[model samples]
Target: DAGITQSPRHKVTETGTPVTLRCHQTENHRYMYWYRQDPGHGLRLIHYSYGVKDTDKGEVSDGYSVSRSKTEDFLLTLESATSSQTSVYFCAIADRGNQPQHFGDGTRLSIL
Candidate 1:
């Protein structure tokens, strides 16, 4: 909580538009991730970066892209907003995959 924060904590946008959410961290952790949480399914990973410029797609990465050019910042961009993309986005960090993750509060996004 204290180590991570997401911008536009709440957002509403029209369908088929582009939206970008910013995730910032103060702990300088090496592993950062973006995940969306929905009703039944638990948090689904969208994308993650192991280090600056080194990233990978995750389970729900279809319309999303990510960039991390610095240790303290990671960005998530939705190429085309869809109603299905409406959900709470969370940013998390871990020293490594084996460690427990620390999460940001969340970003609530809505697509009309």
Candidate 2:
């Protein structure tokens, strides 16, 4: 599990509460990403980081934010949880943008 690890493998939160999910990697990859997987949407990118303090919004960044203060850690934060945001989140890392990414098992989040 040195490649990647996601904390709080599962979580449940009430609507309007703030939730933060962590993704840790030991591979020291250059590209780290946050994605949410849902029934009809498949996998949707939420945010990504190219380097420390460098991040960008993705297709579904509306209700989420990300931070990367180090090479090994990437965090995804749901400012205020909502039922519509309930889904499995996955963290991925790659040496380069074009390289295949390695993904963590996933963090299942449910908001009531």
Q: Which segments of model 1 are wrong by more than 4 Å? A: none
Worst 10 residues of 1 by lDDT: 1-10
Q: Which candidate is the best by lDDT?
A: 1
Tell how far residue 48 is off in model 1, in angstroms. Answer: 0.7
Q: TM-score for model 1?
A: 0.97
- What is candidate 2's TM-score against the reference? 0.96
- The TM-score values for the models, in the order shown, are 0.97, 0.96
Tell me the tens digit of each residue's lDDT in model 2 across 12-72: 9899999999999999899999999998888999999999999999999998988898999
Candidate 1 on 21-59: residue-level lDDT in tens?
999999988999999999999999999999999999999
Pairs in steric clash, model 2: none
Q: Residue 58 lDDT in model 1?
A: 96
- RMSD of each predicted structure: 0.8, 1.0
Residue 54: error of model 1 in Å? 0.5
